[model samples]
Target: MSRLALPTVIALALALSACATSNPDVIGRHEAQRMSQVLDATVLSSRPVVVEGNQSGVGAVAGGVVGAISGGSVGGRREGQVAGVLGAVAGAVIGNAIERSTTRESAVEILLQLRNGERRSVVQAQGSEQFAPGEAVILVTTGGKTRVMRAPPVTAAPPAPAASH
Candidate 1:
């Protein structure tokens, strides 16, 4: 056989071998393997959180000075000190409220705990009812959400190193 023909035949044989060598035991978890059934579930809940205060440079300094002066006037020096503290606390609360009002909280995350102890979370709109933690939802690992099957495990050899530029 010609040298060129030999290389072509060898290349075809290698391709055939690679195809035949794929793992028989490994299978699509979603389509072929089937859902093992959810044995148990747990619903995830979000904790109510108070937002931190954001005091702006000019506002914080000005508020502090005014609060201090007002507090000082009623009870002399000691009263002024107390007033300053009260003023700072009030200002901080107001500042935090303003910040929170501007930035609304995002959707709550729902977690599903399987009997097998596997857990997954889905973000749902705020106030929306979510799947109870123990609810049975088919858990199929895939390349993307909603896709049923996962790609087969790669068994190809590592790619050759690139040539230096």
Candidate 2:
């Protein structure tokens, strides 16, 4: 058991580290940059929301390996092989669950009415903005995903470059 402690801890840490970088609504690198559809909408409703964590099946596999090695070491050669198999199964299950539970994210649900008389609801992570009912907000959608953000302040555009003399 003592010999297994370090490897077990390392495996568990790696599994958890994979969960720490998860973002529920991050645009991918290959996606077009800032090519978002800007929609004007009024918030019909807003509420706090939770985005469930994603599971990528890493936990179960790791758990199974650890379990197998630990289990197999406890008995004769045949028992060890059987133990390894059982360990792998148990590891996979636990690893997957751990990955999901640890990666859960916080979000907000916003109900909006588009200017064209359409209603839509979007749930996004509450990174820096909050929403309120009846508030005018901006919906920025890109690559089929949308984000709710504060409306850009209305301002006059900078004068176009002066014509050359």
Candidate 3:
């Protein structure tokens, strides 16, 4: 095989791997299934409020790789190594910044009630378009992370009896 051909194939492979896709962390439906538990949150407030935040991962990783490659492409072998490290740092910073600017975070504040009749206001992370205020949703809590899941609204409990003197 030609020397140029090998390098070209490698470059193409790396570039292809850098592309974004639906597979965040490449874990597939496993994480989605796990996230379903958070969808069971109870509603406390009659009306829900929407809040936005940034979700980051792909940007950081892609930035790191791109930075490393750009850096390594500098000068000779020794300089290239140095460049790679610096590039990675710069890339990560830029990547995170870009992600922060481009991607809308999936966190929102909602009022919910637990089965035991406790009412609380909580902030939960959710996917875009999946959770909305005023729309019925389920809150799932798992692995110390809380997420809002798309679900049918839970029926409200009957009002308590009035006290008589």
Candidate 4:
């Protein structure tokens, strides 16, 4: 394989690893993961969340490598080496900026009052329902993290049939 600069190599690695955050144990799209606590809570309030962008440096390193490889492909050997170095530096900067901007996510912060009379706040990804104050919701907690969602409705069972004469 052709030689790659450190930055270029790093950038490529980051790009390939973008999907590492996906959960492998997910059984279904809408199902919640088993939690330590599942309780009904009242939504005291909710606020929009602006998640910070990633600063993993993966972009810079990966970009640098790609830039270097393409740069080295041009001109003579000595000139190609110089171009590769320049390309790597440029790639790193571009990659980092692109990653920071693209990786940002919108979320929500919910303040809940549990049935146990304890109050707490949770930050979770935004779902179908936009939370509102005074709403009844369910709290699911696991590993110190919590998610607030609207509670499923209770249904009454049908009465038994009468005996025939």
Candidate 5:
């Protein structure tokens, strides 16, 4: 690989890995310090699922650039131009596939029943927490996005002290 190609490939890799995630454990910087709505619910069902991948075009662009550069070094000027175009087209397709595969995530589909008798279904990327049917969990919503997590154990409140006479 050429001097410029190695760094470009590394940068492309880093960019691909930085794709956004819907994991319940991950909170965006913008969501920090924001108030969220919480609802108590019980898992009616939990099943494994796959989250579809994203196609943001970053991979295609990066791949095209790399391909052009690599192909431009071949043969004479006319041959190099033709090869560069062909390489770019091929690279773009490959890159798109790579992006899709890498961005795909293992997720779960959870059916929940709220205390008010309302039912809701949510799909989220798998994280440190796992859910099972009949498990207590909380649905936290912030900025229109919601995540499900295991609810904390309930504890009794301390008794109030008697007023002095």
Candidate 6:
């Protein structure tokens, strides 16, 4: 394989792996301008958790192509053919593993209690906001996805002035 081809294949794999995200801070384009249900709750407990990675075939395909080309350039014609097949298989497995590991996310599992004494558990990718036991938070749900965020302090509204006749 040409030196340039290897780098291009690697760059494509990296770009594809970066496409998956479960971060609470990131809102998808489709979610914008949509109304969400908000519920008040208090954090009962917070714990660290791991969000599993995804398996998309793009990685395997990319790796196989790169490996075949690279291995095909090795040894005599017959030997190169055998090596190419083996390299493609090995490369595919390694690439899939890389994709999975790169996409894994560090997250948190939160147990919360609503004002009505109802309890809910949520696991989300760790974001800028952190939850602690006894901390007040709001659960915002949009399109069936929920995110927990710190709630603003309650403030009493000022009285309105009398209206002119």
Which parts of model 6 are misplaced by more than 4 Å? 157-165
**How far off is residue 79 in model 6, in Å?**
1.8
**Residue 45 error, candidate 6, Å:** 0.4
lDDT of 5 by residue, 1-165 (tens): 645884676477557656589999899998999999999999999999998887888777767777777777889999999998987887777777777778889999999999999999999999999898999999999999999999999999999998999
- The total number of steric clashes, by the backbone 3 Å criterion, in model 6 comes to 0
* TM-score per model over all chains: 0.24, 0.76, 0.39, 0.70, 0.89, 0.89
What digit string (tens of lDDT, one per residue) describes model 3 on residues 1-165? Answer: 233433453454344434423211233344565643543445544333434324345555666677787788889999999998998888777666655555433345667665566666666434353434455555555555555545765689999999999
What is the C-alpha lDDT profile of model 6 across 50-74, one tens digit per residue?
A: 9988788777787788788878888
What do the candidate models score in CA lDDT, each in turn?
Answer: 0.42, 0.72, 0.55, 0.72, 0.86, 0.88
lDDT of 1 by residue, 12-96 (tens): 4334333321122334444464544322344543333333323333333433444444444556677767876886666445434
Model 6 lDDT-worst window of ten: 1-10
Instruction: Order the candidate numbers by TM-score, best to worst.
Output: 5, 6, 2, 4, 3, 1
State, as a TM-score between 0 and 1, how close model 6 is to the true structure: 0.89
**What's model 5's TM-score?**
0.89
**lDDT for 1 (candidate 1):** 24
- Please name the candidate that would achieve the greatest lDDT relative to the true structure: 6
Q: What's the true lDDT of residue 63 in model 4?
A: 78
Regions more than 4 Å wrong, model 2: 1-27, 31-34, 157-165
Instruction: State the lDDT at 92 in candidate 3.
Output: 74
